[model samples]
Target: MNTVMHRKPKPYRSERTTAHTSDRNASAFPSKRHARRYWILLSLFLFGGLLCSLGLLLYNNPVPVQSPSFWPVVERRITAVTTMAIAALCQSLATVAFHSVTNNRIITPSLLGFDALYSTIQTSMIFFFGAGALIGFSGTKAFLTQVGLMLVMSLLLYGWLLSGKYADLQLLLLVGIILGTGLNSLASFMRRMLDPSEFDILQARLFGSVTNADPAYFPIVIPVVLIVSVLLFLSANRLNVIALGKDVATSFGINHRRSVLYILILISLLMSMSTALIGPLTFFGFLVATLSYQVASTYDHKYVLPMAFSIGFLVLTSAYFFMYHIFNAPSVVSVIIELFGGLIFLTVLLRKRSL
Candidate 1:
């Protein structure tokens, strides 16, 4: 009777609900606008990067060849652009996926011992098989073998850690850091024992340089990248949910473990491709991922991934251009990139933001 006499319940619009509705409305169409803006920015960045690279190519005198026609020059430019583009794409994708899985911006796949493992494997190959043995193998075969070994090692390390009772995200990260340190020590020991000439060859392999990219690897890298890109695009929405943390993602009916595993695999493949193509980039991934996050200002993977790729392409291309053309130091591009990337890394840390 009391309920019957009670005034019709007011529409159940709590303040929180009202606020949520407002937020939803505000963000709804704005994402589309942001998407458009991002595409425009991406196009502009690509143009700038290309222009810089082209300018560098033109300014540099080509090596004298049987054919001095522009076609050869065009081919060289194409090759350079293609290699850099692939490297950037792989690094950016790996970085973004790595951040999503670890739920941390400051960390990159490289930090998790991928690069270290790569170095160890390369050094071991040189030590046991000798430089001559490695030379006997084609570049593509060596690259593929390196990638395969890295993947196996990564899986073993990550799988072992994940199989433990305390294998939470933080634990995985801690283990990664420890493993990376150990691997670095081993690599240092190997380097110290190597002859100066061997060390020179190894030193070039350790740094993230694009100058000596093997063209044969391009065929393998391009297809792998395309396939992974498709997989990533399909899983973008899942990544967004995963970023909300494990419980929320589970609540959303996402298979959190499976999602994480898939993402990790994709990340490892990307890391492998990038490392095999150029060399280990300790900071490039972190730099691009952080910059992309800042520029996008959104946690949605759909926006974040593409933006990261664009930014990476722009950075690498521009760096290559400047180092070659202006500085006349193609060999120093990696150093320059790391210098700026390090500064940005510090800035990000000071701001206390995650990529």
Candidate 2:
């Protein structure tokens, strides 16, 4: 009567079994629903961008669709669209990559002084040679000159600030800021000395706009951008590791300095190309990166980069279409963008309460 009943033995899970079970729920997103959400957002951005692009091309067409002149009209608009795409690609990628390497979300690659350098170059051209010369400074040669100068300056900074025992990222940025301040001051002084008419001419070049981009430069600009863009996209994985900080990245067997240098060079090429082609879009990149982060809701650069690029394309296209077509205030489009971007930046800054 005192006999105990035997209980059924529980099955023991092996480590492999446990790991597999845990991994079954693991994904880029927290769950299946999140994965679905990300994809849906991405698709929406793409679709919206597509619609805006079409609107740019077809809205308010002066020529009839059947007319022989129709395609030419469309072709002319295509230049603007292409310029938007290139700017989006360059700014979005370069900003994201710069943020990753620096491990800071608040600062953009614009802090590296590309914009200042561009302003200085334009100002110098106008200051020394006159407005006529500045006007003549177009075509492939002028485009290449701007790009080459920016790259050379960036390379020199990297070499001087990142190679020695005292090499520090903060130091590099400090120097960049100082240089930018100096260049900006110099440019401002030169502007003050110019006649109103010449100042008027240079003012247009100073503003970041698609009209600043000449299609003639496309022959050289497109190939370089595509190549640098691919290289940056490929570096996305390494960026993810670098974003974890130097200690973590080193533990993962990554050459932290080398990776940082590589990324900086790529960023230089991207920013140089973008600033040269479109002038100083200072906050556009920050705007894209911030929005993309909110939309993507993840830190994976693979997703973040694409999401950034898509949002960038949509933002630029939509902004241009609305301002140029609907609002009929095309000149203020860049100003509008910068305003919103700065507002977003301040909001993010206040929320974080620290840089």
Q: Pick the candidate with the highest TM-score.
A: 2
Residue-by-residue lDDT tens digits, candidate 1, 1-355: 8887565555677566777784565341257777677778878877887787677566565664455675677676777788888888888888888888777766888876788887887786666777765456447777888899888877876687665576676777788789888988887887788778877777777787876687778888899998998799788888888888889999999987778877888888888888877878888888998887777767778778888888888898888888877778878888999998889767976786543
Candidate 1 residue-pair clash tally? 1
TM-score of 1: 0.85
* TM-score to true structure, per model: 0.85, 0.92
Pairs in clash, predicted candidate 1: 105-355
Residue-wise lDDT of candidate 2 within 1-355, one digit each (tens)? 2334334333666465777785675355766777788999999998999899999999999999999999999999999999999999999999999989998888889888999999999999999999989999988889889999999999999999999899788899989999998999999999999999999999999999998889988988899989988988888789989999989999999999999999999999999999999999988998899888777877788889899999999999999999999999999999998887678767866886644
Candidate 2 global CA lDDT score: 0.91
Each candidate: RMSD:
5.5, 4.0
Query: Which model scores highest in lDDT?
Result: 2
For all candidates, the clash counts are: 1, 0
Model 2 per-residue lDDT at 158: 96
